[model samples]
Target: MMNHKKILGIVLLVAVSISGLFAAESANTENTVKKSTIIYTIKGNAEETYYTMMDKPIKALGYRLPDPRKHVNQVYKEQYGSTTLEVLSFMTIVNDKKVKPLLEIDPKLAGFNPFNLVIYKHQGKDETVISHLTADAIIEMLGITDQKVITEYRKQMEELDALVAKTFPSAVVSHGTYEGAVENAMMHYEITFDRPEDLDDYIDEIQEKVDDTFTEKGYIMAGFFDYKQGKPDLLPSYDAFWTFSLCHFPYSYTVFDNEGAMPEVAVFAPCTMYMYIKKDTNTLVIGMPRLANWNRFFTMNNSKRMDFLNKLDKDIPATFLEIGAIEVK
Candidate 1:
């Protein structure tokens, strides 16, 4: 016959043992059901023969080198949700111009550009998919050649220059413009920056400088405008104004911020200023601004744009962990 205290102790021990057994069984079941992730690593090289056939002028121009380490690494991390699948591509030293021509010639070759696609099982039976493609790929698909593209680009750039001159005949002092090829037309300007923080002080300085040089010039500084903040590094606001001609334009004091993980290569963010000028008592529009991201130009129903986005999503994963070189066998 056991004492009452002994019986109570036995019961407590049995209860604890049973609880421990249940916990172990539950953990084992979870481990058995968890799905294993698969990573695919793909490798390939650009065709050297194709690049060799490029035109002399095109060959002479500096080529955009594909930095496998930075670009590939960054794209993998940014696009894919998991760092599991990795793609490593190499390019043979071929003429720069031939590369674009080769890609343009074949639509199927489009996937050769750095991109990623992800697929996973969802809702018991349904499959979910996502993709991403780099900006380089998008630009190539536009089928824009140097001659076809440069002509329109130069015209817009020149118009912008003329507008600046007409707006600030005296204060303009010295101005210069640079041209480059990006996803869209690119232009750079070097204007006078007298004061640092005080926009009012800068405007006053510009006005005084202009007035002293061109006494009778029809130029006056309009009030400043503020821009809504977007992606921190991509869009930075400084000071903007409307000219006496009623044109709205904004000039940024900060050049570019390169402190973050990714540096902004463009000299200036897309600055669209509306200028209303009086031409014989009627306001004539002068400047039509455009942004660097060409995708925004098309309507939502555009198939090309949709395809581009789809390809991008496929190549790039939705999460950071999915970024990495996968061994594609």
Candidate 2:
């Protein structure tokens, strides 16, 4: 009985080995030769096309440009004529613990309008181009013409320029200080312009008007900081105007304590002027954080401020990632 049992066990072990060999061969054959088929469709306007190519894949999918009438909208009557273009893009990675394929399509793309489409799989850091299509024909179907279209477009740009000018303006502030026995009060005014040429004329006219206003109030110009002009690499170019003043007081000692402490600090103020010109619809842009600081007095007071501002201004025109021009009504 013991001998018979040993023979049966040996036969069972051999059969298991043979089954394992056959399963391994089948897996190798399946992996060695495999094929797949994929299909895709493309759609969008010129603006959409620009974004699809330039911006990050994911971010571009969600962004939507404002309605052309509400904002600025520019159209060319001639094919491939000079036209403004804006592009925006961003990407996000999925890192959940589940085991999934290397690449997955975003469901948001199904509902939103995108100008172009590229469906490709990436194997090892390399991209495999599976399918692609351009939606240029869709843009042409809009049928934009040059005659009445160009005139209306210019009107929109003018309206947009006026709106921006009214929104942002240059101004000044007044502060009081105690310098020993003297109670001194100062007024700081700032003026900014869109173009460098506009700066000179605007400042000149403003200075004349301001001098007359302060003259009646017995306010004399104590010091003037010459227009320190420099464009930061990544900011807009605008002239900054700064001036200081000191008003005469009749009873300086009586206004202060006998301890030589000055008192009765009164701010005798006048004009806070800001002049801005819209040079061209295409030229105005505030691209960087530092550019926003150009008119900020706290940031502009440093000795290195002009250098930094100019460097930023010069670099901004190139650093602008997305830009658009629209005619506003």
lDDT of 1 at 276: 21
**Model 1 accuracy (lDDT, Cα):** 0.27
lDDT of 2 by residue, 1-329 (tens): 56988999999999999999999977675444221111221222223432343244322323222111110112221222322222111111111111011001211111112111222121122221212111111111122233343343334323422322232222111122111111111111122334444555545665565555544544443323221223322112323323222222222111111222222111111011112222232132221122322222123333353454465334333222212212111
Off by over 4 Å in 1: 1-70, 73-75, 78-191, 195-293, 297-329
lDDT leader = 1
lDDT for 323 (candidate 1) = 20
- Worst lDDT run of 10 residues, candidate 2, spans 94-103
TM for candidate 1 is 0.18
TM-score of 2: 0.20
By summed lDDT, the worst window of 10 consecutive residues in model 1 runs over 250-259
